[model samples]
Target chain A: MSADTPPRVPVLCFGASGLRFAVPVAAVAALDAAAPAAVSLAALLGLEPHAAATRTVTVTGGDRARALVVDAPLLLRVLDVGDVVPAPVALPRNPAVLGFARIDDELVQLLDTERLLAAS
Target chain B: MTDLRELVEAAGGERPAPTAAGAATTPCVGLRTGGRWFALEAATIGEVVALPPITRVPAAGSHVLGVAMLRSRLVPIVDLDRMLTGIATPRSERGRVAIVRAAALELGVVATETRGLLELPVADGAGAGDGTDDGAAGPEGASGASGASGGEREGVPWIAREVQHAAILYAVIDAPALVRAALGVAR
Candidate 1:
């Protein structure tokens, strides 16, 4: 599994308001359109560009997986390197998402893949 | 004369060891509405935040205030008014949200107003002090029926004597029952 293997495709989402994000091939908890779309910490921070705090999102702790609730937002697809990102500050609490990285000239929060799996 | 203890015992499953005088212990924090009071069983609360802006989800069903991010999970928001008051009012400036996590589930409730939490005398029916604010969506309140009625307050109004303008009565609500009912899980 080196240069011989192809990178996994990551999925992108287009929020109804036209917000787009690149999600990891693995960190997706579940895609639910349940009003007030439910999402996970990984899924919420796992996407593409967003202005800090301006993007209203609700985070909840769940069993096996935390839901990333979205409302009127659509989903897209992309490729994920499956990179494992650690949170800069140690979280004393659960669902603590990690800091950000610059991708394609846009800042994004790298999600911890292992933790997402353990929860899922 | 109906001894109140006899009335409670008459409808009892288990009774605590009674003191000879039946002196009441410390009072707990409970929300009052319609002249009645309710106590939220402690030991199960997670965190509390102001009611956040909720996006509507098509086909998600009423009572769901879209999803707000609590900590990190995307738990659906349940409008307590729809659960207890049987009405669906639009999200206005006056509302309270209480987020509680229990048994791997996190819940946020648009209480419209948050009556402070109180640890009350443990009643027999108060089984499971699970501290679970069940938010499955209960009784369907008249949706948007109160949109024009904006003069509302937040939190449960136990102190009816302190009523305010755009006043809506706060019912002594059971969080779990409202959720179950709204989710269509139970009657």
Candidate 2:
């Protein structure tokens, strides 16, 4: 960790559309059960939804609360704030992404839980 | 097969040529509409977007082709060719939407294809037929600008000026004025 880097924070890691995704662990109220309400991440990202292995991660919110479906799970890891790079303007515009995080030599897109649920 | 490129080429616009000495230039995104060449100031453009599935709005008016989700914001799509010439643009993948923002209003205008940015020299006089009172319409000078007028279109007065590059004439659209007219807001 460099002097300018922020401390690591807990994130719920998962996979969808063959890409790794992470959401602030605090935003996830619970996991591994049918959500009261949910929207497929694939649908929001405009990608084909995986037919199988769709698991729900209930997100924290009120009135507009919703869940995110992750096709599979990767272990949760503490990601450094400095490791998350803001998305470049040229990338296909999606409001749900906060940025990208590098973990285990792979790029994991950090999801904005509130924006994701609001969009759903 | 339709020669899509030629069909949608900006009217009267020539391929870019060398800049004239001492002539001021402005960057613009060249586009074709109603068989006429038009350019929008590149600064006014927010981004270039693919033609998304526009949700048709009921009774919104002919100028309104509906709205589409652009980066999570629902932006109204106006058929510039239809708005300017009253002729519907044929639907094709070649069609592109230029997202423009002004006066706090962001909307999308469909064009044949964006010819990127070109540095064009301003014309010395009023545009050939782009004057306000003459109501000189473009090649497709059909009729009616909107339901508001009989012959003149709201965008007519908004023609800031004209520019020529490579022998092609382009009417520089006034971004704010265009937005106001599209929203039917009083100038």
Candidate 3:
């Protein structure tokens, strides 16, 4: 990549409560079968609890970790840093929201695993 | 009080002779929502456009419907009806979005319709008042019901004052306060 080009990072995208969200691949330690003890990502985000979570994503930050349950159809994508823009200043500050990026003509809320785990 | 001529002169501008019958006016954009009339300062409004598809944001306040990409910027679309009246704006009633900007913040406030631009007479030394005057004259086709009774409702300050134009009352929105409220920023 040219020096002027922003670096692209891999992220795991998933759905929860009918909304799309993503977290950096580096923060995801494992993707495994759904665990009954896994916390609902939708509930953590203050959305209605998902009826049934099909998978469990193990995310880690520093020495802390969390098992977040999400709905089906998870996908992986690489996003350019420059394409990720901060949430509008008028939006209420949410610690888990790192920024926003448009992928496949859809707006995705990029998450910071550390902040998301801390907020939980 | 300093006269308008003196204020104009101090600003390095030509001072035109004042007319006794001319009242100061503020340019505003008239909006209709939930069958109620409202006006926002024109200077604070960026534009009014047809409603666009919105992507919901997680953890945002209930008043926030979602965000939309307008002019390559992610602008949060807020439900003014919900913010003031606790009623979510139905999709059938939302036809336009008013892009309002104040300080470093911007938002798309949902509207049922736009009444275009208007020049509203400014009340002299008018502070944002409690909207307690139930007898205020309303415009044609207006419901004549007051939605809010004071400068603040449920601790959120929004309306600057009620202005009468063509025998109709338009709640002049305090754009900065509304933006702050949407951001959940303390006064």
- Clashing residue pairs in candidate 2 (N, C-alpha, C atoms within 3 angstroms): B11-B36, B11-B37, B14-B168
Candidate 3 per-residue C-alpha lDDT over B14-95 given as tens digits, one digit per residue, 9 for 90 to 100: 2222224455456567777665678887767777888898988886888888899987889999988888877876665448
For DockQ, the strongest prediction is: 3
The local distance difference test score of each candidate is: 0.38, 0.63, 0.74
Native-to-model Cα distance after best TM-score fit, residue B113 in candidate 2, in Å: 1.1
Q: What TM value does chain A in model 2 reach?
A: 0.81
TM-score of 2: 0.46
The superposed Cα distance between candidate 2 and the true structure at residue A7, in angstroms, equals 36
> Between candidates 1 and 2, which one is better according to DockQ?
1
Cα misplacement distance, residue B18 of candidate 2 (Å): 12
State which docking tier applies to candidate 1.
incorrect
**Reference-based lDDT, residue A46, model 1:** 39
Please state the Cα-based DockQ of model 3 relative to the true two-chain complex: 0.53
Candidate 1: lDDT of A72?
38
Q: Give the Cα error of residue B40 in candidate 2, in Å.
A: 0.3
lDDT tens digits, residues A82-110, model 3?
Answer: 66866787577467887899877778899
lDDT of 3 at B34: 67
Off by over 4 Å in 2: A1-120, B1-20, B122-155
Could you tell me which residue pairs clash in candidate 3?
B139-B168
Model 1, span B1-187: residue lDDT tens: 2222233335441233342334221112233222222333333334456676553332235556555544433455666445445576445454556554333344566654444422222343322222322232222331212222222423433111111111222222344544444444433
- Order of quality (lDDT): 3, 2, 1
Please give the range of 10 consecutive residues that has the lowest summed lDDT in model 3 chain A.
A85-94
| Winner by TM-score | 3
